[model samples]
Target: MFFRSSKINEFRLWGLLFTLAGMGLMILGTSGIVFWGQAGKIFAGIFMVIGMIAMLISVGVYFWAGMMSTSATMLTCPECSRQTKMLGKTDRCMYCKTILTLDPGQATQHPADTTQT
Candidate 1:
């Protein structure tokens, strides 16, 4: 639970970072950052392209995270007694970082998510 939560948080942060980077790159490319007449213009175009790609990738990552949220299993942490969502088979308590599982023997019997969107 904790691990999955942490990863989700990281992914969100990374998406924001990538968005910022793309904006920065686009700004730099549009501004007079490079000076070489035609060559400068070409460099700026390349930067713009790279920035667009980064923005697109960030959007995709965010979408993927949102989709995964629908299937997450929620459970109350025994250590911290707080509710948290588990993403994968290996999850920990988000509050106390305690390892959590469905069941030792029935670990493989975890239900598949049928919830859509």
Candidate 2:
């Protein structure tokens, strides 16, 4: 419950974060010369290499997520009446964040259907 995002969305979010981090690292590397003069070139090269590795990782993540999304089940959300993708037996609506499940055994009662005295 701590993370309520859909599986595909979570992967995309991580990929985006890695991409931004890689760009930031590359920028920082180029700016190293401004801070350390001649010796900063070495630091710049190291940072740039690390940034490239991060960018590669981000690309891999995006590709993996894309493949998974294509195989995921597409269904209409009962609460929001919107088409959403599900990664597993249970998932949440992308737009409305409503909890959904495909298992009939678990559908006897919904979390949102509690009655109070």
Candidate 3:
């Protein structure tokens, strides 16, 4: 395995948060809570556009997170001895904060690959 999958879930959480925020903004825009003049209409339209963009971004993030989660490998951390999912080439034990790698060949690899995913 490369790195832990909770990272993917992190992205998923952020996506949900953004989706909710976007929906809230959309509702606020439609309610015209900012103002009542013609400028309010313009602001509302802008808000709606921005909210839509945020929702789209959230969707993309959710998709990416799902894909990553699928590829992630589950393993027991030697340090913590607990089950953890890994993402990239190297990752720290999510519980005990112990750095770990699934590939023995990577044990002596370059410093760049040692980065926690």
Candidate maximizing lDDT: 2
lDDT of 2 by residue, 21-88 (tens): 99999999989989999999999999999999999999999999999999999999988899999988
Q: Tell me how far the alpha carbon of residue 56 in candidate 3 is from the true structure, in angstroms, after superposition.
A: 1.2
**What global local distance difference test value does model 1 have?**
0.75
Measured by TM-score, the strongest candidate is 2
Error of 3 at 54 (Å): 0.6
Kindly list the per-residue Cα lDDT of model 3 for residues 1-117, writing each as its tens digit: 234434655687789988998999898887774557666787789889989998999999999987887788888987668987777877666577666677778775445665677
What is the overall TM-score of model 1 with all chains considered together? Answer: 0.68
Off by over 4 Å in 2: 108-117
lDDT-better candidate, 1 vs 2: 2
Write model 1 residue lDDT over 10-102, tens digit each, in one string: 567778888999999988887644566666787789889999998998998898777776677888987688887777666766567766777
Using lDDT, rank the candidates from best to worst: 2, 3, 1
| TM-score of every prediction relative to native | 0.68, 0.87, 0.64
C-alpha-based local distance difference test score of model 2: 0.89
Pick out the ten consecutive residues of candidate 2 with the lowest summed lDDT.
Answer: 105-114
What C-alpha lDDT values do all the predictions have? 0.75, 0.89, 0.77
